[model samples]
Target: MSGDLHTEWARLFAASLKDSGVGHAVISPGSRSTPLALALARVLPATVLHDERVAAFFALGQGRASGRPSVVLATSGTAPGHWLPAAMEAREAGIPLLLVSADRPWEVQEAQASQTVDQIRLFGAHARAFFDLGLPDAHPAALAAVPRIAAQAVLATRWPLAGAVHINARFRKPLEPLPTDRGEPWRPKLAAIAKAGAPRLFPPKPAPDPAAVAHLVEAVRANPRGVMVAGPLPALDAPAMRKAVARFVRASGYTLLAEATSQLRFGLEAVRPIGAFDALLRAPDLRAALRPDLAIEIGAPAVSAQWLAWISGAEAPRRIVLPGERPADPAGGAAAMLLGPIAALLEAAAVDLEAAPPGADTASAASCYAASWQAAEAAAWAAREAAAGPQDGPLHEHHVAPMLRSILQHGGTLMVGNSNPIRDLDHDVPPDAAPLEILHQRGAAGIDGLVSGTAGARTVLDGPLVLLTGDVALLHDAGGLAAAAAVGGPLAIVAVHNDGGRIFERLPLGRDAALADDCEMLFVASHGRAFDGLAATFGLGYARVETEEALRDAVAAALAGDRPVLIEARVVAGGSATRAALLAAMAKAAVAAVSAAK
Candidate 1:
């Protein structure tokens, strides 16, 4: 039967999206969203995905890759909930996801509405903003609520705190198809939806308060040994801060320590901080010498537990934080918080700070910082290298990361799988070289999204794309490889094969040798074979390597071609020895480096 509800919704929803700067949508098909699905299909840039969970993640990756919001459409009930894991990750990692879920109208809902679960607040804590665009009779509210809710959600997502937005549209039945004109495209012009929300853009401004700046400048000028730590900011905000803060830090004798994820790693007077200093920062001499008179922070929460803890305990001159309406850190106990634009605050201080004067003293301080960092770096690398080695000249986890790193350094873009591959890459990937835009399936950390994320990256980025994944990750997304290979692009899939689930084997449950056999039977369900054949089956090039040298050669050779290739390297399964040996070696190296520097 025909219905105006579906058509009205389709029109409103389509127009809302068009107005919201959403150029693409990743949709998963189903009955409840017939009208909505049709609406998305009519939208040119939208793409359809079969799995709702993968679709959500694919959209997340698309958002990350494109630097814009990507809508995820799914039918009602269990399907919409499939997005939970992705939703959690997006919330934490700060990506924009517009979740458009379809539902049965009110009367039919809850009393066996089939695919309905009071979805009004279904996502709850995970979503930054929530709205319900129910039936056409409520189209006015639907038009009003969706755009406003989404803007807030996206703003929260892009702000100091990141999260997703949820919009559930309940449709009344006979959910009819919409009539449209043919030939000419179905482009609908949307009137202003409730006088569009305020732009979330952060503008350049002078100091927020002249008095506050002057006080900060006076404090810095007085303290000879202060440290300025900058945290990770969104890609959009980091550059401007980097330029503004560079002159300020250099003027005072303060050292600038920036995190790897900070995006400010390239700017002037910025030194890459030690990743974590839980153990190192506790040292009596280091603590006393490095303690700052004042600490100024400008970015998201610091991820290092040690750094946060150290600053909390160390009696500094004062703690001044420039959050600018960003979320406050509950852990930053007793630190003075300032609510204003950071650049403006700095400018108001009007302190003419210069770079640390050159000479033996400056050289000495640089040496001290470099030596400390080198020691930590060496210890980490050594420990990881010791624990991870080639298994009988065949594949091993350690062997694969370095090899893949080698290949990627030679010009291919890298997409790392979640879990072990990323950790291994962190330990051994070449550090001195340019930063590789590392794409991780961090949202949900599922194994099913690698192929699609890698492929999506290839489409958006101009570089040669490489996906470094584990065996399980590769198998879970086997179909994705087929799609990628079929698409035929300059992509490479490198998998570190260790049978299955080595991460589980490190648990205390694995300590019982008698249980090991049972555990393997229940958990390590694996088919130890080359996925190269799978690629070849799809008419794609494939390479299976046993040793480090072979893998490197294969990767190098693959990079020379235009076709997509899959290189599988079988590694020794990680066990208790792997963990123990790695930790011990790292500790030993750390002490040694610290002793030598002293």
Candidate 2:
């Protein structure tokens, strides 16, 4: 075999990717991946990162933000292992990602060759599809097939469901672009095949079954008291889908319970979604009064424990789920599953509602039911505001969350970190705020890659990007700060330094007084370091703010600037206790307000 075979094959594969609409590539520096790296760089906008894990998550962010797959290139051995977490997230979250691992040739299999492991199916079930492209060959047929295989791999990432796809490429020595002993016999044929170009493929959007739509419409007519639960919907970020969802909610008259990451929560007051469901449901009376006869869920499962428990209870409503690619019924209690595009299904339901007549007095009852939810939602937000006291008093997640609205008033992306940050943002941020694009790693709900993911999202975002993260989550992906800087976009990171894992403090383990010392030592894992020094290390501007005004200024400045900035908001120790107390107060106030309204 000629040494130029691998380089030629790599060039053809990279060209195929470009033809298939892959615009960005994240390459982790390694020797085995040199050919592909050079080829991809020539055809696409490429970002090189030192850590494989950071590269993978960065690519994951791009996929999530752009709704397109970003190719991730890594060398053989454990280097590919670092991508497992991001790959799992991509699969679970339905984000398109293409993972290409460069491997040693067949002769070194199980022979203890350095950086050589069984590269076949490295990502396992986490990937939507896996292909082992055998070693580069000069054979006419083999050379001609490289472009087709590359096109197929890219298409697989989006087809059945948008998820990760793997391509294992084996290479011989002379991975560089240097000429070898063999002449360029196959070059002309390869160029001819490349000139033909692969077809541009798009994922098929299955229309909602007509029968299923009619059944659901009939159910809506019978069930006056219905709830539309909107969960984490990253796919609904597109304007067309968001508008479709709004139309369905306004036409159906079902009380909408929208999660923070649902993309339907912040705007669309004309639809009147119940954004305070988390706090309002905490009151038993409100929960009982708001129970519905039917529940329709879209997107992924919700993040609220109270909402989950309430929906899955023994007296729970009969559930209908519109699961896009995979079944999202976590409680395994869905009465009917409608598999189709969410936007299409919603639009169909809205159109069908005009034809279906409601049962006698059903319309009046539904109106009354929706009115009650709106009243409760208003009470919940008012009660929360009353209990939060003066925003200038102390720094907490509650204060930090409301500040986000002002930062993105003109419109931008808000990336919320997992654990307490997401919960706080969900609970406190008002539904009437300016329209913004919000993203979170709710697929796995882990706090591993917050920084890198934010950085990745920045690459594709048109406006400023802000990340709300805890100290522990920021520290977990500290290396990602380098990647963020390298990407060179406007990014502001608000690090809530409340010592450590304050999220654990809200769990049962955190409240065990008998094991107070152990709980603090093990569960919270308190770290006393500040983020200013870390910011300096990464050449990012830093600020430490203790008051609300200072935080507002810091965030505004960061967003206005062209470089990345890290703002540390020091939360008072035991901020979790403060938050818990606030929730309790809000719950009590909400019940009284509801009772008075009744």
Candidate 3:
């Protein structure tokens, strides 16, 4: 009826993806995906990859970075299932990924079809939505599904509760055979637009009953050491509720332990920036300050085991939460689950409270520790600035992270590989005054999604994105580099090649006497000079840095270049001892300062 089975299949796949909000697709090559692969290859804004699992996670990372669903395309059987880890991650972390699994035609189904398996229900509970394509339906009905299925997948991914969606498709043979009058492939030029929907439900919610508010106020008023603890929250109407919360905190004279991921965490001096309450509670003075008659909980729970343990085992019998529906404890374990928003309830209370007394040192020592941490960061950067010099050749992974930071300037988002790259970055790069969004595959902590994530971030923001990765991560998503080059956007990759898994050498695996001294399986090593050739092969700008000066110059050049560039830095494994020594020196300075202040 048409040109060839592959052509029709390819057209449907492209149409479906384009109609959805997903502008990026990570494709892993295989025979089963010939039609889908050919379709993506001919289309704009699609990337072809070699590793099925990595490609899926790359797309998953892209979705996480961009705030949109990024599609994953792979051939059937284990190839489709390779997306399991990434799929599980997206489901839990609220990133959306569309899995397009190509399969054998229905005629060959369950008949020992090559590379065929029951792809349906494979993702099981991991996917938010699932659809099996290539049924006996008419072409018109099939065509009609292209847009709706795509949109649903993206919506399911981008929502607050996001997850994976599967589109299992089977294609007939002669996938892309020539036709007598094979016309140029149709490329749809329609722009994506928001769909018309019912008016959003922003129903007017009244404040908690005045008596209930009074109950909370009376509870706080009765206790001399009542305090407020705020946790991470979904985006709140900060401006609308700030005044109310401030008045409540002022009325109750409650010390606020604000988390950075919370609505009230920022824009306040008294509220401390302690990352994990557990870390703070370990200090004696901080634990003493937390000796409260009542702890008013708000929003989601904090990420501190110490805080929870302290509350669970308090000597003074702390009131860990105020009560109501949509309460502080999602697990129903808090002392009291307060009804209504804290700010609203507090407003009704309007109980008289005192300001923190001048020179009273109301804040815990942990608050001071946070300030000291800032000073240590400044001192670390000062040394780095002094020690900063140019070098080129095989690069040290340890050195690359900081140099990349210096090269990229302060504001752009940066994604790093796990293992050595991220560990190196966390140790070296100092905190900036400007908002620098640092991202990683921290949820799953995989090394396979660097390029896809970078590309997705590039699409969402008009700003530049630089990926500082190690050789393993680079090779894992090397095919993604081609996508970067093809897109011609603001993304740069700096790959540090130390040859083999340097992380292993630092582990017990390297030191075990049972292991062979020169075993290929355990103790592998590489000479870091291959990135230039690899970059050239992929049509990307290549810079080879061997000395300190050359490394700096190469980094500077890549940042200033037009297209996505790769700077390959090589160094030996043991070269990072200097960095470790420097960190230890700075940490000692902080420890000494705390001791001396006493």
Candidate 4:
């Protein structure tokens, strides 16, 4: 094998992304990616990130918390255009990212060099596949086509099977890389490109079409005024994808309406989870007597603007839309899509409606509005226990999502962020709180890599991360506070900081009188500054609080500390009189629990 051709194409592109498994690589500081960042920090598990758009949303939150694909590299004008908003938020949150970009030759861009352009398909169609390792060579069939072009850029970001891909390498000017026992004679081209894996997983989609799952199991067993909706679960806290979203709400006895970044709103066992359907779907006679005559939905379209305007202003329900990836119907009210693998099309529509078996469904069937969604979820958990029973009020920025879910306990990992902290944790959590492994970017729900996508999903979630944010999404991700002061642990941000744009005073152009002075100098851009001197110029650990019992003892001493803190609960948009007395006591106990529905 001819030696030192950019160190044998950066050691066969870091041994084909460590033989296609690719756990993490992020890197950023350039010099044409120093021999592909010193051969991915001499073979795998890399990190560096000196802000290339917070290292492409920190390798798209470690390819969305380790479902794999996290290489990201970068080096070449506009450092790969700051990874096109983390490749359009990993092509709208289906996750999985590879990116990589080093580039230079094509005769140094036909000699107009000095950092060339047209870095080949620079993330257009926000990449699902774009490989072009066209130059740097050593030729043992070009070092066995650089680990089968780094295993098809780790299998086109593993798109509906993963998401962003783009490889683009090019290198020429002796871009470092000579040592390592003189490329140990290209070590058997890393087992013939790690025996070409990953090209088959997604090519097998045809199975779920049995008459579009028997008309989605006869519109979910002829609706007892049906409803399922769930949204946001392209895999996280996978227990066989949360028992295929609890076997599609126990063989479609419906009444789920999940959200609160649905991991089916809690570790659902005997189903029927509504998580106070954003205050029991704000009753219009209990949403006109639980309206759904068959709804379905499933993934994405979360942060509910009144449950997407009550299923896009219902007049007809037969909706459908199973969407595991892309089919965000937006009010053309789905009608019918049901493609495939939403956990084997909801476990073959629960064995064609014989039901019971996923966590062995126990109850929730008799519906005529399940006693008006259990008395409007017990008058929306007693108006969220009288908005956390006063306890010396003052903390109500929508009571910090049930006070960060009562400062978490055994269950951890929660991010929230984007505007009014994910619409006040989709209207204060508790329609029986359980599934707590939350993360919300809601794909392209941009606050620009909020704290580097929760410090790259805090290296695959174990403990200590609770972000919650919104002092203008922590000042539009103050360069993701250098991964919250160089990633150690226990982040616990909780920042409600009302200095401006309190989610543009609940939109509609913040009560427009022809955009009240451009919604208060451009969308309530108030500057009461103070983030405890920006958490002492980012060495973190600051507090501020005021009441709601010192913001619940500064969130139980910032989740019993370890490092990076911040607290700041200083909210006081009192003009909205404690969010108009908790949305007028959860809209007068949602029409007095649907006029005391019997």
Which candidate gets the maximum lDDT versus the true structure?
2
The residue-by-residue lDDT of candidate 2 on 1-598, one tens digit each, is 6547777788889989989877699999999999999999999999999899999999999988888788999988899999999999988888889999999999998999999988788888999999898788878898777877888888888888778999999888888887676557887788888888876666666788888788778787778799988888883355655787787776777888888788878767467778888877778888888888888988888898788888778867789998666788888778898887777888888898866646558778888888888877777788788888788777767899888876687788899988998899878876864577788898888887779988988898888789999999999999899888887757889999889888878888888888878888988888899887888888888899988889999998888888898999997776778788777776777677667767
Judging by TM-score, tell me the better candidate of 3 and 4. Answer: 3
- Model 1, 1-598: lDDT tens per residue? 2224466447556655655566577788888888877776675367677777767766776666666677788888888987876788677666777788988777876597567776787788888777776665534544455555545544544555456788787776676664544222122212354235323444244346656666677666655455566554544454466656655655554555554334443333344344323333434555554455567766655444446776666453356676555554545653567666776565555344332243556545645655565575556556556655543475656566666655555444567776567555543442433344556554445666677656655555676677788888888877566456534667777877778866556556656788988777776665666686788776777877777888877777776788888887765555335645654555555666666777
Name the lDDT of candidate 1. 0.62
Against the reference, the lDDT scores of all candidates come to 0.62, 0.84, 0.60, 0.71
lDDT of 3 at 362: 33
RMSD to native, candidate 2: 1.6
- Model 4, 277-377: lDDT tens digits are 75555556667776767777777765767677876774546688877656677777577887666777777877877643322232344344655776777
Q: RMSD in angstroms, candidate 1? A: 6.2
- Arrange candidates, best lDDT first: 2, 4, 1, 3
The alpha-carbon lDDT assigned to residue 486 of candidate 1 equals: 38
Local accuracy of candidate 3 as per-residue lDDT tens digits, 1-598: 3445356546555665665566677778777777777776655367666767657766776676666677788887789878887888776555678888888777787898678888887889888778887631335545455555556655656543567888887766665545645442322111111122111322245567776765676676566465566654332234444556667765555656554334454344333332323333545544553455667766555444456667656343456464323344544446555666556676766543332221334334324534544343344445444553333444555566666666656456666666777556645554332334455564445666577566555555556577778887787677667656655655677777777666665455665657737533645554344877778887888776665567777756666667878877766556445554554555444444444544
Candidate 2 minimal-lDDT segment of 10 residues: 235-244
Off by over 4 Å in 3: 1-20, 26-44, 48-54, 75-79, 134-136, 139-149, 173-399, 459-461, 505-529, 572-580
Lowest lDDT 10-residue stretch of candidate 4: 356-365
Instruction: Estimate the TM-score of every prediction.
Output: 0.73, 0.97, 0.66, 0.41
lDDT for 276 (candidate 2): 81
